[model samples]
Target: MPFGDFQKSSKDIQLLSEHILAAECEVPGSGYNHSEMDLDNCLGDDNGNFQWGGRNFHSHAHNIIFHPDEGVAHVPVLRADLDGGSKQSNVNLGERIGNVNGHLVFRW
Candidate 1:
């Protein structure tokens, strides 16, 4: 079979796992929770806003089931959820982080 045809055929009969992970740098000593910052705080007294400096981290996992007989090449039927938290500085100027949890489900 041609390379393209072989590739296509292989894709048609496999269960695949896909994952994405990302992270950013946090502001030094800026320990803040997402819920604590509001419009007022974000927008400083001078209307100059102080944006959240903490890095946002995210991850996603997917399980793709392929069914060639049904004419469906791939179907993503599994997922994972994630959550996280942190703590502020001793001076109370920063914010606090919280807990993180994740849930995974697979559809058979």
Candidate 2:
């Protein structure tokens, strides 16, 4: 999938911000531009409150582990050696295992 596919939509982002505010968590703000890392804007403003943006997102080192639904396979299976016909032998292992609604998993 494309990198942009991973990013949530503007509507989804708005909803998330609203939800966070309602839950009494740190308020979201456009602290820094995504294309340009505005360090000056972030460091200068110190409300003692919490804030997050691309500056932290891009600077921070973090690992994301994507877990598919229970009993759902992540990747397809293919035989390296072509003993049998390529088209006939190759099978999608996930199809046999279970189905995962990607929309539901990634949707807001």
Candidate 3:
């Protein structure tokens, strides 16, 4: 199978974001960019404000970012593997993205 086959497209991701952020999803979230780290929950955001955490299962790269920077007209996904798949690296990545949207949007 092609590696790209497993990759998530911008549209797919957008829908996923919408689904995940939906109030009816039953998953409590801190909006798009707002995040809070909790040891119990295994989420490490350092209290900066991150909406979600993404990890490349194959590469072990950690990614955590906020709302897409619509104003910037670009979508950015911060990936960190400096610590060798360390969960804390995800938190660092989120801090870099800050609270903003990118080019990718649900409506194209």
Regions of candidate 3 where Cα sits further than 4 Å from its true position: 1-59, 85-108
Quality of model 1 by C-alpha lDDT: 0.20
The lDDT of model 2 is 0.20
lDDT of 1 by residue, 47-98 (tens): 1111223221112111212232232533212122223212211101112211
Winning model by TM-score: 3
Candidate 2 per-residue lDDT, tens place, 1-108, comes to 322221221112111111110011111353222121122122111122112221221122112122222224333222111222222222221232211221111111
| All candidates: TM-score | 0.16, 0.16, 0.19
| Two-way TM-score contest, 1 vs 3, winner | 3
Model 3 TM-score, all chains together: 0.19
Ranking by TM-score: 3, 2, 1
> Model 3, 60-88: lDDT tens per residue?
32343333322243442333333333343
Report the Cα RMSD per candidate.
Answer: 21.8, 19.8, 13.6
Runs of candidate 1 with Cα error greater than 4 angstroms are 7-12, 16-63, 70-108
